[model samples]
Target chain A: MVYYISFILIGIGIYGILTQKNLFKFLVSLTIIDTAINIFIISLGYIEGKDVPIYSKYTPVANFVDPLPQALVLTAIVIGVGTLALGASLLVRVYEKYETLEVEEIAVKEARK
Target chain B: MTIATIFVGILMIISAIYAIEAKKMLDSFISLSLLSLLSVFLFVIMKAPDVAITEASVGAGLTTAVLILALRRIGGDEE
Candidate 1:
């Protein structure tokens, strides 16, 4: 079920990226895709009736969820943020130069110049 | 628990769609934040507390800030 949801989100993100003319919407779509992938990765490690990987005196150690996917997702989240920041900065730069956020307008301007 | 997880997942999809389809950039950003918040909830339900905290802080918090700042810099929703 979670997998299905994530796949649908990925589809939506791709649709947005392909159809939207605004540069900022493109970045938003990228963020959506990043988030869906992260969710899908974390869900891969989930087991029904299992506890989190955190250890405590009362909790049994054997029934904890798989920690590997969590670790990978942690790294992915950080990288997603970094990329989002970079994309946002690039959007700002593009807007500064083109005076518009529409991708088609930017292309036309570039062609004339 | 499964029911709750499914419910949140559905909400996440709805918000993701709204974020993509929203007319104004500000509305889209708000929907994006809502999607992030729902994902954090879903993370907690899936027995991934660490990822939930990280997402709540970084994904929901920092990402929204960065996008809003960029929107402001671009002079907001000219269309």
Candidate 2:
């Protein structure tokens, strides 16, 4: 249930991005969708009633949740941030060149030119 | 227990819907921010604080700001 809901949220965001008219809205949707999937992927490693990952002195097999997902999510986040920055810069250039933000309008203007 | 997760789950769904159905780019950005925060909260409830931290910082914070800057530059339809 935990993982499924996260996936559904991600799907919703992706649908929005695909069907949207505004480039800015699509970009925002893409970022949210991206994060949601990362969260979902990380959450998959968690088991109910498990403790943090530590094997130093005490506890047994039931104690630790999988640590790999946490690590992966961290890496995904760094990449997400970099992609968002790059995407935003591209959007800025698109806006400057087109002088309008609506995707349809921009396309029409390009077609005319 | 499952209750907290369920609650966060509902919030996530609502935020996702709002993010999609938003009428304007700014509205979409705000809703997307809300959705990201809800996902972060869900991650925390799932016992993944590391992911929660990054989502809070990158997803909810920096990403939203960047998209908003993009919005300002693009100046969407204004309708």
Candidate 3:
């Protein structure tokens, strides 16, 4: 289920990137798509009847739920934050220089210059 | 219950479709948030509370923040 849904999201993101003409809109769609996959990755490692991998007397190490996925998701969340900020700043710059948000218009303007 | 899972699965599918097919960027963004939340429900039913929490927080909250920030940068919608 995770694999299938994740792939569907990737396809949607690809479609957005391929078809979207608004630069910021494209970025929003892309982020949605990226998030879907990240959730999928976390879902993959889920194990029932096990405790969180936190070190404590309640949870025995032998019965710990997979900790790796949590760690990876943490990293992904940070990276996503950074990428989103950078994308937004670049988008602002793009809008300022081109004076329009349309990707085609921006490309045309750049080419003419 | 399997029936509920199947029903939730249907909702998940619908949300996924909405996320992809929405014409407005904001609509699509909202749909995406809905889908992730539904997936968290799915995770809970599948017996993964930690995943549900993470998905609800990072997947829905943080991701929504990123999308909204990106949208603000884009400004008003176009035809």
Q: Against the true structure, whose lDDT is highest?
A: 1
DockQ of every predicted complex: 0.87, 0.67, 0.33
Q: Kindly report which residue stretches of model 2 are placed more than 4 angstroms away from their true locations once superposed.
A: A54-62, B75-77
Q: Of models 1 and 3, which has the larger lDDT?
A: 1
Q: How many angstroms is residue B29 displaced in model 2 relative to the true structure, after the best TM-score fit?
A: 1.8
TM-score (C-alpha) between model 3 and the true structure = 0.75
Q: Which docking class does model 1 fall in? A: high
Instruction: For candidate 2, write residues B21-45 as lDDT tens digits.
Output: 7776677778777877877777777
Stretches off by above 4 angstroms in model 3 are A48-62, B1-10, B43-51
What is candidate 1's lDDT per residue for A1-113, written digit by digit as tens?
Answer: 88998999999999999999988899899999989999899999999888989778768467798899999998789888898999999989988898998978888999998
Q: Choose the strongest candidate by TM-score.
A: 1
Higher-lDDT candidate of 1 and 2: 1
Give candidate 1 regions above 4 Å deviation: none
Residue A71, model 3: Cα distance from true site in angstroms: 1.9
Model 3: per-residue Cα lDDT over A1-113, one tens digit each = 55565666677778777877777667666776766676677667767667656666776456766778767775676677678778878887877788888878878998998
How far off is residue A95 in model 2, in Å? 1.1
Best by DockQ: 1
Candidate 2, residue B43: how far the Cα is off, in Å: 1.5
What is the descending lDDT order? 1, 2, 3
Give the lowest summed-lDDT range of ten residues in model 1 chain B: B70-79
